[model samples]
Target chain A: MENFHIDGSTYIPRIDFNAETGVLEIEGESYHEYTTEFFGPIFSWLEDYLEESGKEITMNFKMSYFNTSSSRRFLEILTLLEEYQNNKEGQVVVNWYYEENDVDMLESGEEYADDVELTFNLLPY
Target chain B: MGYMEHFSVKTFKQQLAMKKISLAFQGIFSQDVLALIGKSLRNTPESRVIAKRLFAIVIEMAQNIHHYSAEKQYSEKDGRDIGVGIVAIAEDDHHYIITSGNCIVKTEVPPLIERANYINGLSPEKLKEFYREQRKAPQREGKPGANLGFIDMVRKSGNPIEINIKEYDETRSFFILSVRVNKELQN
Candidate 1:
């Protein structure tokens, strides 16, 4: 499968999913008006990549800010990863990065960690 | 000329200054406009401290107007229908107040009031639990958002969401929402 990438804008995140390395990264702010439109293709790409490749994947999220709608989509992504890991397709680890003083972001990561059964790491920058 | 006869920019400026409004916008709530407002908040020194909370509240309230406001304007730039509303940010010594107002159908008043009251009554822990529960649920069909905006706003602000509904006409009512964020960071 081909790699997927999109440059981040003021209201959207940078999406870089490398099929060769099995390393997916979503970095920057995500407050786009249409969350589904922005995230739908990425979800499809992840599904295809998981089905096609037997390699382990690491998803890194470095978000400065995201609106409530985007939060739901992030949870959906985590749920998908949890399912992929559960099916024994390949190992999956999520590194959630937040700023050092951003308690809300850290707590958001903690909430997601509690919700999913995947290996989730909270890293502060 | 007729409308301009009574309009006074001086009076408007004075009113804004009196209210301590640092930023204000009254027009269509488009994504581009929101981006500009967000950038302005980030760039302002006084607001930069509370920018995260202020921005989050602005997005939720503005998006509520964008999605559900009764007043709609077709934007040639966006090539879509956008809602019209007013948003303002005021700062005092300790708090930044974010206020947004828009028109809504009169029928939406009761349910909105109920929702606001319910959210205000919840403790912080309950609010978080409610947010998570709603986040896990499937997005409602035909809705543009996940329906967790209000809860999330209150959670982030660490305060109750205040709402006012005033009768605009027989068929429509004006909806106003205000949230306050502390200038100093709080745990």
Candidate 2:
């Protein structure tokens, strides 16, 4: 399996996924112009990885901020992971990291959690 | 009150004038205006922050005009909203005052007024927390409808949000929010 890496920015987060440990880390602000286009490849990569490798996956997300477009893509990613888990290929866990004092981010995670069958961890960084 | 208020050429002219209020983003009406505005705003220390927030807020506001305004027009390449509105930025003794005004449906006024109240009541620290809480919660019933853009703009601006609402009609109302970023807090 190949890992994907993205550089971080003030307005967007850097993403790094480890193929060995199946641990994916996304950190940064996430308002992007080209929404699904930017994430399509990442989603395909993950889907293929889980389908072929059948490995357990865990993702750690530390985002300072993100726009609604990005938020939609995040859910798409989670939905993809849910599919993988439901298929029984492997288990996937999502750990959402935000500042302890940041209530909006926590609430956002909870909202996303409500939709997915998988569990999401709300962690303070 | 009249349907023409929504389409009056004057409305667009005023919005354009408000654009000029920020020399950095003003005089930008071209295929590359967004890119140009981005470049100019990116050059300044304080304006950079304001610029990004503007990107999000304006998009939301423009969308609101497109969807809700009881008017219609398609003159601009992007079909700029026909809603009567003005968005402005000015400097005062200390902070930069950012203001935006537009006609809204009467039904839309109360929630926004409540939002403005909620935003003003919080301190910077609390605002930050509110932002996090909002982010962590799943999106409201619909994603686009969530008021995160407003909250995010307030959080990014680092200023108290002030709002003014008046009746344009029994069915339509005007809404405005202005905030100042004290000079001391800005670099």
Which one is best on DockQ? 1
Q: What DockQ, between 0 and 1, does each candidate earn?
A: 0.71, 0.15
Residues B14-54 of candidate 2: C-alpha lDDT, one tens digit per residue = 86576545532222222244344344545545433444554
Q: What is residue A70's positional error in candidate 2, in angstroms?
A: 2.7
Q: Write the per-residue lDDT of candidate 1 for residues B1-187, one digit (tens) a residue.
A: 7667789888999999999999999999999888998888886564343577788889988888888889999999878998999999998888888999999999888998899899989999899899899999999999888799889878877888898888798899999998888777776
iRMS value of model 1? 1.4
> What is the C-alpha lDDT profile of model 2 across A42-89, one tens digit per residue?
887877777653668898888866666587678778877888888866
Model 2 error, position A119 (Å): 15
Tens digits of per-residue lDDT, candidate 1, A1-125, equal: 79999999999999999998889999999988889998999988988887753479899999999999999999998888888788857788999999887888899999999999988999999
Q: List iRMS (one decimal) for every candidate.
A: 1.4, 6.4
Top candidate on TM-score is 1
DockQ of 1: 0.71
